[model samples]
Target chain A: MTDRPKTIDEIDTPAVLIDLDRAEKNIARAQAAADAAGVKLRPHIKTHKLPFFAKKQVETGAAGITCQKIGEAEVMADAGLTDIFLPYNILGRQKLERLKALHGRVTLSVTADSATTIEGLAGTFRDAAHPLKVLIECDTGGGRCGVQSKEEALALARQIDAAPGLFFGGLMTFPAPGKAAQAEAWLAATRDLLAANGLACETITSGGTPDMWRKPEGQVVTEYRPGTYIYMDRYQIAKGAATLDDCAATVLATVVSRPTATRAILDAGSKALTSDTLGLPDYAELVGEAGARVIGLSEEHGKVELPAASRLKVGDRVRVLPDHICPVINLYDQVYLISGDRVVDILPVAARGKLT
Target chain B: MTDRPKTIDEIDTPAVLIDLDRAEKNIARAQAAADAAGVKLRPHIKTHKLPFFAKKQVETGAAGITCQKIGEAEVMADAGLTDIFLPYNILGRQKLERLKALHGRVTLSVTADSATTIEGLAGTFRDAAHPLKVLIECDTGGGRCGVQSKEEALALARQIDAAPGLFFGGLMTFPAPGKAAQAEAWLAATRDLLAANGLACETITSGGTPDMWRKPEGQVVTEYRPGTYIYMDRYQIAKGAATLDDCAATVLATVVSRPTATRAILDAGSKALTSDTLGLPDYAELVGEAGARVIGLSEEHGKVELPAASRLKVGDRVRVLPDHICPVINLYDQVYLISGDRVVDILPVAARGKLT
Candidate 1:
């Protein structure tokens, strides 16, 4: 795929362009933050979904890679990633069979909170060569997935221990930023409960890119997974996770139409930059331009309400830092890796659109 | 993809289910509306990028197909479609070279709004064996892309007429809903201006799914392209473009977690139903559940705030009708075609992520 060109200027529009220098710096910065916190770094592959970046993270001292879906884990395994932690409560027989196959291919561990999911896992991996490891997902403050309280966490851990062909690895939670202490306390209490039940948990995982730098000082967790730290987005910048200089990926688009004096349309829209505002009013912020902003999108056209002082015109190429790059990266098959106007590589989003 | 299940109940979670009955009705109903208006129907493939549906539209008496991008047109041509209209201002050398190659394969016509685009088309096809038909996109009331006024359309038409390898085929516009008269008046005025300049235009195309049933009478538009009418969504329901029963696609997701009695988390998130609100507050609306709403998405989990009387529980399979189905369709590689409780067929979204 890198055979397209050697220079960035020759490439087409509506492309996911990553600045390698900024990506490398972002990776190192995240690694250093993890080192300071004394936690094993297992970067989430949901951000890039490319094995090239996953391999780079492993080479940079990452313990393993994190995946959100079975299809993504399958792709990473095909790419020779030996270890993977899937932080998703995979269910149903159709998916469990795929999960079992992936587990056989790699050192796979998955998270679950419900008995139905655990039962499905136990049924699928019954009498396997190696028992599948299961982690209980604890609900700290995100309110999305996980056990609600320490009691629920302990009950689920006991269920995993009793289930056939299953190993109770540990507990994990995706806590909201600023609630690290609360989450750590809950995990610690849950660990105490598990010990009271005559069971010991080996690993405790904590995640969330926003809380990556400030892991609970007590080190209640053994490892951390932060997916969006590789290509920091506007959401990360707004949340004080990373600054604008730390963002690595930008969608390169061309202004195809200028309907009015103060209005222009770009070829990239919700399909390119994504519709995940991450609670922002707009899709993305204009890179290298002040006062100009992307107002809206209609499927394929991004409507830009240009500032009166802006000099953007039709046929002009612009870089837009998306509010969220994970979904945006999943929208394209290939991304151009650039370094100082030179296209260094074009990596395939190998696990893109792995919805099921 | 359907090999995993024998019935709809046994199918996987987070899967796209298309009701074949509703889809067939949508196709026939749209064609009947076009027949009543006495215009050629060229449905846009941007909504359902599957060549199967494109072939269905043509089988139901569609004049041709309209694609938003050249990559879509290429995919349609590969499926043995003879005619395609790309209603986009395609620019850059790489795309133009691909367009030239595609033009040789099918009867391809594209729309242009600027001199830069016209120059690119003319230069690419100057020494070709056949001339390419070009349409001048006029800005009627939809101020996204096109010539702003009648004068600009005439000037671009004149340039198309003067170009060696380009033929000024006609005029086209994607206007605001309920503004067909305004668009017609502007296009009629432009056609008169072109006639006065000794240029004859063959086709006058108007588009928009919202205004499909109400194309301005008296044959102002020779052809119409409506994409969303094939699979109506919540946005269309709110816009009076479709009824609740008109929607054909529904995302089947399992309740993965229940954080509280009043809250439920679905396996389908932004990646399943899409993060696109289309100006709505939530991402998707529950199909049969009256009070349930998809409040937020965190990439893999759709946070649903349940009403007090909601009967949703963990492992319950729910159908979510997205606010917009186009981007949601692009999120999955295969969609299950179902009729009642039977799994009829499986179709791949052939042109799902052709971003180039």
Candidate 2:
């Protein structure tokens, strides 16, 4: 096999490329912020699933890792990292079986918002040697999942404590910016409600890159789990979660065809950067170049509309910051690591495309 | 290590499942259609990207395979496949070198839409021991890529013939239904122009799933390259390209959470099925169910607005035919191959995430 290569042109087009210097800087900055805020940092590993990067976070005083599924948790456990949390509701017989088994290999935890979900998890682990610990997920106001109100959350937490073979660990929410303050208010109310019911709510976790910076001010948040801060995508930049210079990952692509004077095509399209349209608002600043909107995306072509002032020529290489970085990373097998002017290593996205 | 799982419920959620029985039927139907139309069938491998599927197509009488990138073509060639065509403009020094190397391993051909691209390929393959084949790609009005007029296409074809290590193959286009006649006109004019220039215009390949059934009368298309036929998707069903029963690939997702009476969430989202919203007339659609619209999608959660009369419940496994199949396949590491009610094998998406 070939060794690591240098320069953007040296890497193949449509491959994921990460700036190690930028990545390390972003990690250090986030860790410092969490330390100053006096909250435990549990960085989400859904952005960059490489075990090498995960190890870096663990070495940097992170409380634990947040994964999206049991499959991802299994991959991380195989890499010898413990203290894993699946922030999604564990459902179905197969998933429950997998979750029950995961408890034996590591310090595994999960989230739930309904009685049916809690009952399902309890039933799966009822006869097991270990009880399954879980967090009661609150909507706080993302409106995607979780219980809607403090009263609802408190009821769920008490029910979890009452269930056999299950332990109520804490509360978790994927709070949006608009609801961060509301979630903070609800978290306080839920804590008081739990205290009145003689229940202990020690851990209150709030997540989402958009509202990550506000966790310190929330007062009720004991831990923060932000995914996009590690890579800093276009959407996160638009949401003011991170700066353009803080973006660690970029799509290194080549100009394959300039079909017209105004329209040029890149080898990377939805299959490379994805058809993620969430981060188009901050396109001008992220690329360090002017006047191009990703107007359309075919499977293998990204049709970028060039402005009259833009002077890009055919066969020139370009860098694109996708709207969403996680799915973009899932689209490539390997990512080239760059430091200054030299290539350091080529990291395999070990968990790339492990959707199941 | 695990053998083929028996039931969809036995496997994890958000898995890509292929009905092999349906897939074989779909392939045979497409082959019969091409045979009846008296055109050579060279199926495009962009949809599956698996060597196993490509080999199946060849076994079922496909003339060759069509790819969009040299990387994908190289994967196919490594599997002992012989003939291949990359239907995209080959530009830049790095890509040209890879393309020249690929030509050494297989019967390789590429598409060219401009003089610059043709010249680049010519310069790279000039000293090749074997001749390099070229196809002048014409825009039949998809407005994506290709030359706008027959005169421009012929001029480029003549220029390719004049250059070293170049042989004019014929013409290619990705035209829609109403534009097939326009492409046929361009193909006729370009064929005459190439003949007038004393060049043999052997094979005119024009195709897309939408226009596959509407081959124009007396058109110059001697061959067709229709992808998306092996795994017909929701987009194909909507565009009259293929019916829902003809769809071979479906996302096996479990209803992980029922947040509301009106809204239910599935484990599969853009990460599993992808945001490839192509060929579908609208944003999203429900595969086997009616009036189910995918309202929003996060990384791992697909929020669906349930129809008033729908009966979907929590933990129910639903099969969703993705709006587009190519990007969906790129989002998974393996696909469960099922025949009738039994899973035959778990085929690795061998070239999965090979965006480069």
Candidate 3:
């Protein structure tokens, strides 16, 4: 503890820094939005992957956290987050055994799109004291995963209801950006179909940071999961969900080389900032450095295309707002939490690299 | 130790698997090529970032290991690697202090492309007993980090030679693919310029995996550093450097869902395989699936485009050859070293996230 840095300037380059004030405000704002919409806000821990932030979200009136994997949920559970929703198809024997162990410790719910995945889950939780809550993941035009049609969703829900140690909870979806209305319409129709089949659909979960602020006017979605609003990125700004000032997380880097008049290199590269352009023009936007863009990245060097009259010199520090912040946060083992140039804390991203 | 996985089938999904036999063959082949070309092979450890594999490379006749950051070099030095070359412009006071400490522990050398970077290195190593070796990094058409012209190289070499506790080692370049000959010619001219200026150029290093097997007929380069030869990837295959059988690293993922007739979802995603397309067609190539390709990736799901009538089921495991192997390797904490169907060893990626 004695060796800890006292200020942001004392920290090393290529480090992820979270503005504590901005992050807290972001958390409170998202919670308020969900409250006003009368929907439970389930903040995805994938954005920060830190228990500190997850607990803050929960304390700020979030219903529960949303995790994409059992490993992430396990981390949150160990940190005393009792409720979690894993919106993924849990498959295979090894993962199912772990899921069962995790289910015993937390009030866990999961989503499945196929009967094979449901069978695996049902076999694992068949003799548990409490039934595992399983949701039918519907492909509401996202086309990534989930059952294709309303008939398919009904079939999976029926399978879950008939399983030995499983209960059909509801329906879940990860809709594409700008397709929330279509996804809500599909989910509503499917809920009706399930009702006609005598299966009670208790919950409807829909999520995406791009559409986080859009209210569910159809009144179909009961829960919303938004991960990146805690630390909005260039992609979120491009989608009009946030502004540059709302971005709380940035990669602090030093100009290691000024190779040419219009080219400068930073210590942070794909390993630090990540290479997820999310269809953006550049890898990242250099904060306060107008016309300078991270054009390319090697494993450890960020090549910046500078303006002709750029004053960026070697040894000068700069902050970069990555195009996508979720994957960037996953790249680091720990991040610095700062407040107005003071280093407040250093939190380890405990759930990072939990690929299982 | 009793809980160790005995075979590949028992290991969890979304795991990085290193084929021991293929990796060893790749190592031996690269070393033999360097030997045939009469140049020292300094393998960059950024590809694997594991001391076990770095030691294996050293045992296979590599002159030294090249690290992109001082943190990575520190990890390798702790593991008893003596000679490490870091080919990045080392900047900032904090990093310089770490570089000074690392220099005291091992035969450490670094690269510089500007006077500011050189000044910091000289200020840190001024009173040391031994002079630090500093190489001038030339752009050589890479357009990344490095001096743009041969004259800039000479100026930096002169500065290094004149500075206290510093020695001008030579020239280094990470050339663009298919531009090796042009880079070599530029280095040859730079070496001639240094010689005419009474500065002795001891070593000239140039490296890239795309042109690993190509010989330097100009006889100017004395060393070569290739990072990706150990785990050849789809990018290497696209460059005609290696075949699919030569690939040593693959992400073993389980097919979690077949959402549509032409789409299947795997457990591995950008968090495991990374989003580095490297100008390739897809995220990864499924090892044995003829027409299956990884089309898109979320954080925890790989949306694989499957061929019609595909047999990939919900529980079947598949191996994926990523487009770029270096960044993908950095995403995992440990990799299973496998020989045929047996899990031989589980090695921690000790330097995977050493961003600074």
Candidate 4:
């Protein structure tokens, strides 16, 4: 994507604008690393969720896509991509019916940690021609969702094996940095246990942008699912995971209204950048240098605290690196794909705000 | 809307839910207060952009609706709302064109501060059948949008008066606490100026949930537009603007995984509750009774620092009051309308994520 020459007037204050060049480069770099590592790269589409971005990722060589919910998968599936993996527990009749319908339309894979989740999926897909491909989610140390222990993971895998409409597709874990090694160890042990039990956990999928770069080489993971790498956020940049140049997505906001000497407000606020400060230290900062701290954010007003020496004025255009790229993208209806100031194309955030 | 008795087993976690009784009561209360004051109560639909919510507000005696953007107004207009006020300085040809088109469908009123905004509106509606209803937006105290001084507001109002296709509607301000008196003073001066200039400032709309009840009786403002009053947030509750029972919306999240002795995690994170901590005090004490704070929040997990004597277990459901209710509501596709323990209906956030 080319950056269109965005005048201060052209772009909306506090809008998420994507640098097509950086996005393509980021995608290429991630794909190259996954290729070098000899693993299937299933880039998480939760970051962008735009059909155009998904198409770009697929064009650059991706195994499939990964989403957290049915809403996201539905958007991606509608975009013509057939294979998708929702690596989260899908419960409830509404979600299960949607999942079953999706499975009939496309190749769908899901993850489960509890028997209830498996039973829910089993009930929905019991009579379907295609079995629901499921990966037993492991708590490789993130402690969010997954079986806590290797034995527990194996037990769940066995349960999945016994289930009539479920296929034990793989093992998936969203690991934290300190626990990545432990997660890999647990995966290795679980893989060995599955082998000893004469059942194969073919695809070992592990991911999380924080643990993406430090992915264990000799781990049991056959596939890597990393989101946020496509648009490296403030958190990723602050954690030294990606460089400023690697940051693909930014809130192209203009200084809409400046009222005070010390404070300059941007059109973007919690609504634009969102309140997703996961790995990020601040709301958002200057792209290349430390310029401002988000002092406060109302629904539509982002109070930017600028240094005395900073050269920013009302109506000046600035690129804001969102704390978390996913939710920020989710808040906007459309994003401008810029290369060098020129907006080459505007793409809708199709799966944006789709929290079902 | 009634509460639906769906558990973590039934519905996916981290979804936004609306308590119908609370919501309807909130609407009725705001409307009643405004009615007693003899002011047209046009509640801001930005808090819950769902058509169902808007319909309920109208049914409960709200005069019209208020929105921040033309995109939102378009959504409301499409849902059969014939009267809408966009209380933001809408700049740009595309937005202006949409605004003009919407003027054809509904009674549209917009705000403007600079000559540029008024000029844009004038250009857009130059060929329209009726003059564009223009409000001279004044910055009473909350230095977000609007002109700074009453003199500046008068000058802008005069500019609107001279414009080909613009009519001076009234004065509008998004006031803070200390600024209410100042806003009233400004509105009085501006109203006098408009009357002297042979222009009728029919509707003097001033709003802020914190200062909603602090309006000077029978004085300057003719109308009030309060968005958060419909769905009081944690911030409003903390600020004594609302009570917990008055909070109409909350995220129905499950305790998906309990990770530590001191900390318990919820499925709702920044994606659900959002990073809008303006109303929240400390991270660790967010919604926790005294002492416990939200220690950390990842994209999908909210890490809570629990009280030592507390016994929060895995799979327990907790209602989290978002610091900012508007964006949190926008993040979900549907809001479960809860009455008690049963969900009467699921209201789609129809105008959700419309950040155009």
Best by DockQ: 3
Q: Against the hidden reference, what TM-scores do the models get?
A: 0.95, 0.94, 0.99, 0.82
Clash number by candidate, in order:
0, 0, 0, 30
lDDT of 1 by residue, B1-356 (tens): 33756677987888998888898899999899889888899999888899999999999999999988888888899998899999888888788899999999999899899998899999999998889999999889888888888788888998998899999999999998779888998888888888898887799999888888884756679999999889889989988999989899999999888778878899898888888877787888788888798998988899998897788877889999999988998888888888887888889998888777
Error of 1 at A98 (Å): 2.4
RMSD of each: 2.2, 2.4, 1.2, 5.0
**Number of the top candidate by TM-score?**
3
Residue B238 lDDT (model 3): 90
Which candidate comes out best when scored by lDDT?
3
The list of candidate 3 runs beyond 4 A from truth reads none
- TM-score of chain A as modeled in candidate 4: 0.94
Q: In model 2, where do residues sit more than 4 Å from their true spots?
A: A1-3, A127-130, A215-218, A279-286, B1-3, B92-94, B176-178, B279-288, B308-310
> Cα deviation of A157 in candidate 4 (Å)?
4.1
Pairs with steric clashes in candidate 3: none
Backbone clashes in candidate 2 total: 0
Ranking by DockQ: 3, 1, 2, 4
Predicted complex 3: DockQ = 0.78
Calculate candidate 4's fnat. 0.31
The digit string of per-residue lDDT tens for model 4 on A236-321 reads 87777898788888887666555555566676777787766664556778564367877567776677877776767655667888
